[model samples]
Target chain A: MLKKHNILVVEDELELAKSTLAYLTENGFSPFHAKDLKSARKLLKQENFSAVLLDLGLPDGDGMALIKEIKNAKNEIGLIIVSAKDALDKKIEGLELGADDYLTKPYFFPELNARLKSVIRRLNLEVNQEIILNEITLLPEQMRTLIHGEELELTAKEFGLLLYFVSNQNRVISKTTLGEFMSSNYADYGFTDDMVYTHIKNLKKKLSGSGCDDYIKNVYGVGYKFTVA
Target chain B: MKLLTKTSLNFISASVLFFLVGSMAMYFSVRNIMAEDLRNRLLQQQNEFIYTAQQNKVMDLVSELVFVQTTQNKQLYSFSDTVLITNEKYMLYRKLDFSYAQNEQDYKVSILLSQSESDKLIMKIAIMNIGFAMLFFLIMFFVNRHSIKSALGVFYSTIRKLEDFEVTQSSTLSLDTAEIEEVKKLNQVFEKMSAQIRKDFISQKEYTENVSHELQTPLAIISSKADELMQADNLSKEQMEQLALLLETTNRLSKINQALIFLTKIDNRFYTEGSTFSLNDLIKEKLSLFKDAIQDKNIKLKLDLLDITHVYMNPYLAETLIINLIKNAIFHNKSGGVLRITLSNNTLSIANSGGSLSFSEKDIFKRFTRSSENKKSLGIGLSIVQRICDLYSFNIAYSYADEHQFKINFKK
Candidate 1:
């Protein structure tokens, strides 16, 4: 079994923290909630968390200031900023400041969860560079992906996308986030979700044709998820 | 007419009227003065000559007599009158006749006094008067024009500043170059107005950000709680239905808020970064993303991608426009329908097989206005697409000819 990740949520609102904790706990991860930066700092000292869900607005101070301290204290922690709507500049700034990913506020917890996994996966701080799920095996260094012991022919982009999904499996990844990962430049093109969908389709078609069972799941009006269903 | 032209024309007309009145006064007064002086000098000379003639009646017999004429009895007084002295010159002179008793005999003496010198002097005065009036007119005209130009410069500078005003630039108007008091006052008013607009604009942007930030907490809580409720086991049928309705309502509210915020950001000119990329690749990628939906619906996709089209735009907005268009087509289409996308040159056209829309093409781009076929739509997708097209000045045309068609023509 894969190790269940520990998630720390730093939010000023009690209800939001509760929901975040509840969602994370339901997903089989240990969750710690902090209502302010002070508590978050204290929590960071007392325990280790796999990821931190940061909110920019806090009761005591700006949440952006805590990111530097969090990074300084723990380099392995995956930072995901959940901020207010239309604060795209701040989100980019957060990403530049070494936050793994960001989402605007009023976001679904599932989105937060997916992004947390994606960020952690992309960070690749672990020793296991090889990921195998079911009959699919992904060699990250070689940029090669195989299904059912047969080499699957994938374009460079398709290969990268497959590896991304293999690394962050069982999470509902939105087309927007997926597009950002695949092209590394289409995040600004809000319409690229269709492109992400197309790539996922091609990847799935190639995988299933090679005697691999269907593993990619679609969530209508949402996004796609890779799981051994 | 321009301010400068209008004022300059007025000055020209006023100067013309002034020259007309001034020339008449100057000509008459100068002529009168010159004529009076010449007449007085002629009359004094006549008196002196008469005195000399009276002193010696034989002066007429002497060679010094100006004119010596004897007439019987024609009583005509000496008077000065204007006469044509030459072809080009006129002269004023007095012709005199007096009785001179030469050796006690009755005789009529006539004396003619020529005033050619005075006539020349009067002609010079007239020329001087006309020359002075013309010189004054030209000087005043040029001075007035220069002053008007400077005054108009103030307004021109104001116009230039107004042209430079841009909300996205976030710079205030500086019309301190205006000089005229009234014009300066107008510039000051505009400066204050623009400053207020900039302030209001910034505050409005910040307010949206703050308000949306505050809204997210509650929205997150409600959605999360709804998701939790959805997973609850052993729920009654009615309760489950009610929970689903609640979740739907919450989701709808979130979508509306999100769309509103996005529209506000676009209007505020927030997305500034852009780059060039292969639009063909982006479109192909998006089509793949929608493959499953296409398969489930069994819709046939006809692609006529002729060339590798390049688009320079904010990638985020570009992607959004593509997805929204494709999604809208997919959402509104019937099962086993056709979706045709033709890309030729800078034109991209998307058409899908669907029932006739109840809404007119004009009203389709409006937010929250959905077709009768799709109740689940947020209806802001087309609005966002419209806005994106509008921002880039790309033409978007829609039609319903067998299939709902949307065509976008991008600049080459």
Candidate 2:
């Protein structure tokens, strides 16, 4: 059995932090809490955590700045930022700063748990291979995905999108960024946010219909995040 | 006339000075030359008189008589040949009787040396002619000054008008033919520049407004979500408490950002051409979207809307205007107050019962001008309304009675 992962939740609101800790603890993981950057740093110095849930708005300093510090101190540790900042640029910046995932505020707790697990699984991967989550197995090399031990058919673009999501796993992806990543000929193909939405809708239907648990959650006004609960 | 008068005065002064000196010099030179010639002639006559007196005494006597009569008196006289009085005071010559005397005897002369009274008469005549010439020069100077000054006045006023022209608040300044060709060219250039600048300013304003407006909805969602998350009970107590404050601050910042971007876009003229859509339909849709808020406020809405939905305008801007206006009414209205909205024949009017407007009718349309009591208000709603009207050539008017009234009349 994999060792129980240690997770640190850095936030300011006491009730929210306590509830988040309870949620993490109940999900078979040890969770720690810090109200500000100072306490978070103190906790980090004493313990090795598998992942850190960071909020960009902190009492002491910016959450994004702390994300950088965490990455610098430990390259292997997974970092997920929970922010209310929904701008495309901010999302892109957080991800680029070595965050394993980003979740906008007011998120459902199950979604957060799912994302954390996804990040942990990706970080633990030793070699490129098929990822097995519940009944769904995604083969990165073959660009094929299986649900309930049955090969699922996906369109070329749909396949590519699913693969990219699986590759990134827990991260919140913006449509603009995803559009660019999935196709080099987006302009020629007249790709738009609506098209991305359509593809995501279809991808979600296929996964669920094929007996695969729903892993894609819409982040409202931002984009989608693929993770396992 | 003013320019002409000024130029004429300058010309008159200069010409007067020139003519005064010129006429003086001319008169003096002419008088001197004439006097010298007269004196020389007189001397020559005197010498001739002596020569003839010696060579032909009878002819000399006749010449002397003629000279005396011409110089000394107006009266004519005759003398006898035997009267030879040659004192210094007078001269007598032989008198000539034309019928009986021989040719040598026919010439008779007399000389009278008398008073200088007659010399004044000759000098007076010369002075009169000089005076007439001076008067003529003065008249010519005044006439030229008057005409030239009038012409220059027209030219100067036109030039001044062109030089001090402003393009923002007014239409093109009228130009008359009195303006010189160069000035006319300058006026044309100014008109063209003003038109181009106006065009460019409008387009730039529109672009900024559109960009800012486009960015607002997404930002709002981000901020609201963030706030909700921070308030969620799922987080650890400490984490939840810390994030709540962060969320609030972020929410305020995002609101400011949205307002600023909206104001910037509105001011920059980022208006797109609107398609014909039912104003009534759009309003109904918008109201439905705000249904929850309307219910929360317990405000009664009275909409006397027409079936007409076709309005030629940028649908986005029109919708924005309506949203802001309705939102403003809802926020400002008294609890359980009536909100009235009426649309007819390209006119949209909204009125809500509430406290008197926080600003004068004029101040209401200026950006960032909120009611003094409502410090939290961003104060850009009415300005956005005004901007939409300006961009689409709509006429907007404000009035206050029992409640504030905003009326917008769209151009066909």
Find the candidate with the highest lDDT and give its number. 1
Q: Tell how far residue A135 is off in model 2, in angstroms.
A: 22
Candidate 1 residues lying further than 4 Å off, grouped into runs, are A1-4, A109-229, B1-12, B41-123, B130-163, B169-192, B236-245, B272-355, B389-412
Clashes of each: 18, 56
Residue range B142-193, candidate 2, lDDT tens digits: 7776666564565666667767764343365665655556556765775577
Tens-digit lDDT string for candidate 1 (B189-261) = 8988998999999999988887777776687788667656645546565665566566556756776887888
Measured against the true two-chain complex, the DockQ scores of the candidates, in the order shown, are 0.28, 0.02
In order, candidate lDDTs are: 0.75, 0.66
Flag regions of model 2 displaced more than 4 Å. A1-229, B1-246, B307-309, B372-376
True contacts kept of 2: 0.00
Model 1, residue B52: C-alpha shift (Å): 6.5
Q: Write the per-residue lDDT of candidate 1 for residues A124-212, one digit (tens) a residue.
A: 55434656887888766576777877888888767867766665456555543454354332232222455567777888898878998
Enumerate the chain B TM-scores of all models: 0.71, 0.45
